[model samples]
Target: MTNAPSSLTSAEPVTLSEDEAAQLAEELKQQLRQGQRLAGDTQAIERMVAGLGDKRGLLRLTFAESLGTVGSAAVPALCQAMCDHDNVTVRRAAAKTLTLISDKQALPHLLKALLNDDDPVVQGSAVGAMAVIGADAVDGLLNIIVDPNNTPMQTGLASWGLAFVGARAPQALRDAAKSENALIRTAAIAALGDQIQNQGDEEARQLLLGALKDPDEEVRSEATTLMGKLNDSGWAMPLLIPNLQDSSPLVRKNAALALMKLDDPSAIPELESCMSSEQDASLIPIFRLAINQLGQER
Candidate 1:
């Protein structure tokens, strides 16, 4: 049905005079206050969250971010913008900021953005913010990795981001080390050290130990690098001792490097063993580096 000129399409050229627009803006400010307080008034912010579905994408995003900035009372309305809002990027940004305004409750909405957002940029932003949100986000992000149905790449991304968040994601770190995918394993171990490097505690030590023992050479190697980083001085002997004997030459090589950082002579025998066993084999220069490092320790 063709509409008449009186019908206002969202794309219609806005023709308000400057004074009129200024007056309306002031009116909206007052309405924003009243709506926030009374709940009875369907104020300008209300109208905006409602209008988010409007065909004009830019206006919709601007309105959502504006409403999100309005504080706690604005959450119920702005949350709809998290998903119901049209532009994926805008929806993601709104979800990210809303966590700041109110709704510590918005954690769930943010998690949905992690797996469901089709845009990787959007997904990545959600991850950046999820790191801000902390431990609560761990379960969902881990689910993406451990659940095969969740698709490996997506799961890998979630694990990787959670790692950046550090020890807060211990359970996820522990699980990712078990993944068969070498990429997933490498990412998980790297994140393990990273997570521990930030929030490490006794539990983190346990998780890193598991990573140190992972069958994949890369995972074991990264785990050895992380050994030097564990917050507890006690972690040095427990982890470095076992890693010195890892089957992969790279693992043994990295273990030697870590042992040097601790200056722990206990690993001298193990490092010497690795040097003799490899004899300039698969690990080549790294093996030699380990031997030279062991010499200094002795």
Candidate 2:
């Protein structure tokens, strides 16, 4: 939300008596708690809409949150409020409230706010709201994450949003995995595991198989973890075994742990080999545990 000082700006500030503002704020919160709309009174709705840009941040959020709790009925008004150039705090509050309500009908407005809102906080909140909206948001969120032009921090939040989108994110995630940028690929791989996880999508599985061989160690490690989570015998041994010999110690450790999750006896030999060559005191226990688990299952 915009924090521009009221005294410094030429814009007209919201003029409400202190007692009137508190009563309205409390009324909105009370209505929200009771799961009721703002009395179905046009004047009441207008009053809450006016409160959107309250110079007081707490009051602005309270009003916005209450409007969001009102659900689809307040969506149009919230969208309208997001365009108030004179008060960016109101615009941001509207964007954040859209997320709280999770109405897909607000998708267009939220996207607009995300693309055009100058405030970083508003943009971040819009990203989060889109995630709550699910598959419809995948395409937009992917645009942010897969764009090499975006800074790492921006892509990082996009990745987080995509992860929240979960199984609904697979298609965009598949495309992201093909990005020439290793950072994008690694982030996409990790998000895919978080979202897809053993859901039995062959295309997703194949994409992960490709990730397993990625030159980037992070991608390979994440892919190994996904493979174990899949527990598919066709891949359980082949995909993870070679990782046990990977040059990166972290990759080897993850591979062993994945094998333990897969419980594939065929990996026992590889695990033993890994155990013999492993020098890290901490990783040895994991290798031994994986070996024992595989052995007992046989």
Distance from true position, residue 219, model 1, in Å?
Answer: 7.7
Candidate 2 Cα outliers beyond 4 Å, as residue runs: 1-18, 25-62, 69-95, 101-126, 135-156, 194-199, 231-238, 261-269, 278-298
lDDT of 2 by residue, 82-178 (tens): 6444577777787788888888877666666665567777778877888988878766666676666666666677778877786766777777788
In order, how many clashes per candidate? 2, 0
TM-score against truth, every candidate: 0.57, 0.62
lDDT of 2: 0.74
Estimate the TM-score for candidate 2.
0.62
Q: Judged by lDDT against the true structure, how good is candidate 1? A: 0.59
lDDT of each: 0.59, 0.74
- Residue-by-residue lDDT tens digits, candidate 1, 105-130: 65566556656667776666666656
Give the clashing residue pairs of candidate 2, or none: none
